[model samples]
Target chain A: MGMARAIEMAKEFGIGMVSIKHSNHFGMSAWLVQQAIDEGMMSLVFTNSSPALPVWGGRSKLMGVSPIACGAPAGDERPFILDMAPSIAARGKIDKAIRQGEKIPTDWALDSEGNMTDNPASALEGVMLPMGGPKGSALSIMMDVFSGVLSGSAYAGHVTNPYDPSKAADVGHFLVAIKPDLFMSLEDFKARMDYLYQRVVSCDKMGGVDRIYYPGEIEQIMRDERMKTGIPFTRGEIDALNEEAKLVGADTLNV
Target chain B: MGMARAIEMAKEFGIGMVSIKHSNHFGMSAWLVQQAIDEGMMSLVFTNSSPALPVWGGRSKLMGVSPIACGAPAGDERPFILDMAPSIAARGKIDKAIRQGEKIPTDWALDSEGNMTDNPASALEGVMLPMGGPKGSALSIMMDVFSGVLSGSAYAGHVTNPYDPSKAADVGHFLVAIKPDLFMSLEDFKARMDYLYQRVVSCDKMGGVDRIYYPGEIEQIMRDERMKTGIPFTRGEIDALNEEAKLVGADTLNV
Candidate 1:
């Protein structure tokens, strides 16, 4: 709802870098970026979540596994959506590994004393590794500052943990939208985009690789497939959704 | 020179996301962002260099190890400058290793056949690994598109290497500046920033670690130290600089 309002506001204005504060979970960052892409505007979206990773060299968890999403419309090709977590691997994946009783890769995180470890439980209690090491760590710091501190939302260790029901979540978002036609004709932009995509795809692939793909190309494929086949949510997730619907006095999912 | 003009134009136009095409090397990205920071604004600076990395799944070298610089002012403490290369390590490190006859790390790059290798020469001829693999590759793509294609500059395989004297180097840059006072009072912003910094530095350190330092904090310490002790450049770097100065008919350095 807020994202729609923000998009409308950005469209009305020549350019908008909207920041939202005191918001709850806003799903995938790419979904929000796609809003602007659909509107013929380029957008970058960012959000700060609960502390899931530690600051670069510090041991205690002082940062979220912050994510950045950048997107723009291409010609006849799928729109470009680049969404990434600054961590080497998202903490959610580590948690999933722990839940499945599987060992995580060693480079994914560090234990309490800061030594690299493959133990999912220890890594969860410690710090998740940043993408590109220090560089990714630095990018995460900036994202938190921009999305949280600058937006007057709870930042750093102050952000609310979703599992902690007593505290209110103060998640923050930083958004930017620019009119595509402002820089160049949207047609020309699209043509150039198509050319770039072709150039990339025409390159020789690494051995054993299926094919080269742009970031959101796979997502587009998935969406098309899902539109016909429907989303295959896990049974547990469906059950949880049904419970939430019952609590809200709404229709429950049959699945 | 182009950066200065872009800064001035951005200031006069209220808010500007300026792009400079056909520009040469403009020094550290932080220096450009600092220009806007000094004017009581936040800035992000990005530039596309020659190809040093490959797209995520493709084997051929097709992308630069692009860099992103983000910065904002703090209260009394040093301004926060987060500058980073979206690669595991810069190509220069590999070049240095090759020159010194040292074996490179296998994780740093892939050989021509796309297999990871510890040989610096083959890695240099091939493609360097991105900071977080796929994510970093995606970032390099966006940075190139934003800084090059959007700016009417050469992009992807079109960018010329600096060492290729026959072709004119055509680098591109993208800069964005925003007023901090837009959302909150500057004083309040500074206060929040201070609180954030304090919270980060106050964390318990990992074993064998000296202390956690913010992105620019160590650079600040080094600057203070070097101001008294003087910068110690490598012999090869000194010779190269002297030769460059001589070629340009500039006065040679005493050292």
Candidate 2:
């Protein structure tokens, strides 16, 4: 929708603004935020799903592997984008680990009884642990409330599995877009951001730590490097994509 | 400031909204959100601070103990409030532990070199671990960006210690308030929220877990209980307060 139209509709309803909730999985949150940025606004998006992990201290699968993304436009470069799941490793990453026959990280998951485990299968059976512990669990809970509860959608363990076709997976999403010139000049905001970035990066590092990275820095670098080298897909992922292409009766595997 | 005025000022600057980076360690985020609620809006706040502990994998002080709070006004009952820190325990709790001459929980903090320690002093020297591990670290980073980077405030280790006045701590905060009625009817929104809450809470628990608690459930209970039975203060806390009172030439312990 046109940003102006959306904002106008929001005003008409007596709502301060409209935040779309329970949106379909939109791939990368950065992509959607970029759309808002294109309309000259800053954006934030959060999504929640089935209980893939345990809350801090608790061993049962109780919370979703929620994810959050944010973006702001910059004049000379790509809009700043920050997108990540609230887990040490996202489910997709875990699937990849399983396919690669790699041992999952110990902290990433717990067995059914809540003991830490490194086996991919065990991690899958067990809940993915919260990020920091209680903090991550709390974040996951908040995401569930904002994106799911407030939206009147499924939450936590009750949410349908996004990966399962038989289920509707009543996923929920929360989005907010702010015009840059709301409180301060966009130019000034950008300048201040630059200053903050510089100061943070220039700070002294802890032992063995070479540098500090802002949230979106590594992602940007990864996008650039991957774009140049072509996207790398594991064999299983390639097969899965090819199978989907076949189902759609489309050409597959140009490479 | 009135919500309308704040929104109007923000709109003038091309900002679709305004989010305050509040200081004074606002005791309850819900209180701030209530302001928005009084104006018929939704609001969110995010804050970050020093490392209370390490991420999940290795034992080392790395990230800040952070918190994110949000509220959405309802029709009759109090607005839904969600406030939480990323750490298993706040630094203040450790101080309380010291005063009580009690050993801190094993999971709460680590020593200077990252070994788990129940000693409050060691935990103070060492960093407080993230709630989940990487997930906690990730949330801390997100809060740092939203509250610090975006809001043009200090973040992570760079934030000033709130306890120590001599240091120039630019502790960062982010606040956002929106009028939900702008998009849908208030009644409809509330009904939806009620449905979502009921469904999620009704879901079966794993093992012996008794009941599912919503985000603000515990806090609401605590607030009510504390209000009826005055908040308790430890002797050490009372002594400290008395010392400060003396500096200001005021009597103490009337309560």
Work out the TM-score per prediction.
0.89, 0.73
* Runs off by more than 4 Å, candidate 1: A1-14, A91-105, A237-255, B1-14, B92-106, B118-125, B235-255
For model 1, residues B10-49, the per-residue Cα lDDT tens digits are: 4554345777888776778878777767776777788988
* Tens digit of per-residue lDDT, candidate 2, span A1-255: 433443343333312233444455556666666676676566677777788766655676667777767766655444556676667667676788889999976767776666778888877777776665444665676677667755666764678776787867777777666555544677866665565445444544433456656556677779889989988898889889999999999989864
Docking quality band of candidate 2, CAPRI definitions? incorrect
Chain B: TM-scores of all predictions: 0.83, 0.71
**What is the Cα-based TM-score of model 2?**
0.73
| DockQ comparisons of all candidates to the true complex | 0.65, 0.22
Q: Residue A160 error for model 2, in Å?
A: 4.0
Report RMSD (Å) for each prediction in the order shown.
3.3, 5.8
Model 2 whole-model lDDT (C-alpha atoms):
0.63
